[model samples]
Target: MEKRYRLRKNLEFRKVYNNGKNFWNRNLVLYIRKNDLEETRLGLTITKKVGNAVVRNKIRRRLKEIYRLNLYRVKDGYDLIIIPKKNVVDISYKELESALIHILKISGMLKG
Candidate 1:
């Protein structure tokens, strides 16, 4: 993802968490808030409870890739933060993708 489309700052993530609406499933939680920009931005949070550095990074990569591949299906002008649950580490890629798509649909961001 491009720099502008990635949520990089602590304050930015905080703003989204405090003001955004959220959706949750067994595997993940998604928070979303409106932004002034025309394109959507994505943030990811994989807590230590999930695993060690290697595991966390792996999950982060999976989440980012899922988002990138489906970017066109999501709505514009929103900041999104994704937090994966502990169980997510063992799930398959297709399950991760489905979980994300489900959350996006609940957020009303998935285009038909």
Candidate 2:
């Protein structure tokens, strides 16, 4: 809910999207790579095809909610980008959250 925390900006999102190597686990897809900073950086990308600006903004909000709730679980020291697919527009919050955790597990960002 704050710019101070959000990974806002097209260029930052684009850099991760284009250059970061991605790995996936279920509905959750991740682009993880090194970051120059001491802390982890996060970005979310939703295209116009996901819907108009309203739909896109909603999706972004939903993603940020997931990230915020799960921030404690996600590891630090990586630049991460999340992209939601068209089918995700219809999914429930539970499923979206599951996908996020699923991929994080796959990436080994979460260890138990």
lDDT of 1 by residue, 13-88 (tens): 9999999999998899999999999999999998999999999999999999999999999999999999999999
Angstrom error at residue 66, model 2: 0.8
Poorest 10 consecutive residues by lDDT, candidate 2: 1-10
Error of 2 at 64 (Å): 0.3
Per lDDT, the best of the predicted structures is 1
In model 1, what is the error at residue 74, expressed in angstroms? 0.6
- For model 1, what is the C-alpha lDDT against the true structure? 0.94
Which candidate gets the maximum TM-score versus the true structure? 1
Where does candidate 2 clash, by residue pair? none
Give me the displacement of residue 71 in model 2, in angstroms.
0.5
